[model samples]
Target: MSDKLTKQSIEETFRELSNWGRWGEEDEVGTLNNVRPEDIVAAAGLIRRGKVFGLGVPLDQPLQSVPHKRWNTIHTFMQDGADVATGMFEGRLQYADDAINLPTHSSTHWDALAHVFNDGRMYNGHDARRFGSKGFPVNGIEKMANRMVGRGVLLDVARFKGVDSLEDEYAITNAELDACAAAQGVEIRAGDFVLIRTGYQERFWSRGDWAGHTTGMAPGLHFESCYWLKEKDVAAVAADNYAVEARPAEGEGFSYPWHGVVIPAMGLTMGEMFYLRELAADCAQDGVYEFFFCAPPLNLPGGSGSPINPQAIK
Candidate 1:
């Protein structure tokens, strides 16, 4: 906390709390080491109601163009013709396919440890030179694909604050997170996929104002939450917001400090732009806050991040 929100503080925290050598000097999977195979077995016990909810935002064609330089995904829909050509498949075997081209940090995506770098260093002190102009030479998103499965706990901050969704520029603090946990009667344990819902995206969906949602001010995670997350030893943290941290940033002359610290420093992957309204509603209706959370990133080798189709089973 001495370094506070400055780049100096981020460096200090990385030196103090990094899992760089805990796994290995050659380790690419950072805090994902906290996720054990047995964690999945125990997570299955949370499936009493046998309900499943997807967390991916629907990626449709000609996605909304937003300000601040972060636009929606581009999905080109296509189909196989019923008329057969030379060397074509047999009749009645036509299908559909879509080619998607977007930023790796697209809707409902996972930010790999290499997503951010500091001073020519990546997670665990890996050299940024390892990252080629094409993609990551190490610590790729594929390394995290299988490692991102485990228990998920939702802290619905909007509901806790007596609002359908929090106002723009609201940054969630550790105290607010604690209050949500207390209200749900759940203790955040190690190896949990801690998901915080700000309810911003869903409200935008109702009004069809993705432009306003994406370009305008919004809620996000407090930088202090990074320290709390590292202390708690969670496998990863995800959110319903785009950057997962508030903007314009709380730190003076520092923008998106937590992304630099948490992904590159703490070695934790962050999920963003999730569709958590249904899951939040389900949890509230049944009063079950924790669930079997399972989300494996797409196996794109050398990818810094991947669009993920996450799910919560309860």
Candidate 2:
């Protein structure tokens, strides 16, 4: 044991451990908390030494949903083909003249702490006042920004299953996650952004029906998995699924158990609909499981969640 075993030192040790097939079931969770800010800085330095990659899909119109009557679009023009007598200037000027129905409901985004709660408190022990007129302070996305720039490990679960996509209602257990990480020759660490690719982003606009077409986590995460993540002290968890957990709890009948467990109780943030294909491909090509990751959500007041344009730099 080294006396200088700061958090950063621990992260580096874990990164090496991941390459050597040392992960899970042997104090992996405890290692996350031991990660030091200096280690994160060093990891970031490595990322900057290489090429930076962006991992986000553009926001588009809704493919399927229970449409609202108020949601409609109208386009207006400031100038349309005005011909001057002498010069003959013909051009069209367009501004905010178009009002399209923005999809506020179906957001492929990161949920802020305010998004979910256990009892009534949120992250950092802030109550509704931190939220002020906005909503929940703990729910604010700002707190998460600090933890966004560490190592990120991608677990290509869909590829492991030998399919372009996982079943719509597939539930990923801790064992499955661990297995996928092992197959990829990677390990999960605290403060490390964990990305699970389910191949759903490939089907973003196939039929334009977002309802039944879009795939999410089976129901919600199993309680054990949530506990595992919390114990690991990961900065955040990103997945291609809607919620990190299964849709509904197994026996409890609640729709979102992971949210109840991770958010309010543990104060963890969940990233949804992240673009993982490119990231996964890059990881495989370079054979490097750890890379610098960055994600800063929009600082919107009173917002439950916001669209995130995240990136992973190797």
Candidate 3:
């Protein structure tokens, strides 16, 4: 590996790992196509204990730590008790109504294929210029609503390494992922949603360090793991971190180099900021790292991403 990755290396990796024509020319769902109906049925069979885990943090918490100065969820009431008391409604059947304003990525969410790009193209060679204030015209978050249900494989890397959380900027390599799965006695299979628990979120919860969890240095997948993910044919990859790839990025001339290859080039969807503490505890107790994973984003047309409360049933 070169200390400073050149532009040509990035371009070559994009060309080599691309899933451009794998599904179809106009495909929007990307690697989610790997999840067949039978895979969903098999995932359902893993729910023996009937214990469910909600994988999203409360959206109302202020996320001032996030990048680009993104604001957290704002819940405002259109009609409330005060309004009712004021006799705002003419009809006797008065009801409370409310609405929420939030950036989709402000909480636990899935990044649509159009959320990132390489050069001037998105997934399946869609022009990046197609996105604007109207949002993505192609490969929008709506296209992934039905494609999110399937088997989920949990690789608790932090627990495997005997740490509460991985050190900052620690990149989990392909070999580490393999070793973690082997230690947990779990198999990484095609069409599975692989969740890597780095315990970064747990650290944030325990310390009340939102800035450290969000904008500060972090641990995540290595750039080389993109090839490993492609080889496994997983439907998606998620983690308990801001970006799924390590921060202070490995490449000298690049930022978020893993995102360049995975999202746009390989057409792989990604989930971020998942709350996996309890789920990891349960998996550790039962020694069962596989579960029925289901998370469907809101069907918003032209959305770049959508907040999700992913569920893991065991």
Top TM-score hit: 3
lDDT of 3 by residue, 1-314 (tens): 22656778788898999999999898998899999999999999999999999999888755457556667788999889998899988989889999998988888999999888777789998889856898887999999988899999999999999999998889899999999999999999999999999988787788776764567788888888999999999999999988988886755446778888899999999999998999999999989999999999999999989999999999
Q: Please give the distance, in angstroms, between residue 94's alpha carbon in candidate 1 and its true position after superposition.
A: 3.9
lDDT of 2 at 130: 44
lDDT of 2 by residue, 1-314 (tens): 01222334333322322311122222212223344698688667756447766766555544233454322123354433332323344364332223333332244567776776434544434455444554543345554444456677777888877877776556677788888788888878767778888776566555555664333334223445765675566767877666666553432323454565566545556787676777777777877767887777766655667666787887
- TM-score attained by model 3: 0.95
For model 1, the stretches where C-alpha displacement exceeds 4 angstroms are 1-4, 61-64, 67-71, 77-93, 250-253
For model 1, how does the per-residue alpha-carbon lDDT over 148-215 read when each residue is reduced to its tens digit?
77889999999989998887878888899998999989889888899999988877778765665555
TM-score per candidate, in order?
0.90, 0.70, 0.95
Alpha carbon deviation, residue 135, candidate 3 (Å): 2.0
CA lDDT scores, all candidates in order: 0.80, 0.58, 0.89
Best by lDDT: 3
Candidate 3, residue 6: lDDT: 70
* RMSD vs true structure, all candidates: 3.0, 10.6, 1.8
lDDT, ranked from best to worst: 3, 1, 2
The global Cα lDDT (0 to 1) of model 3 is 0.89
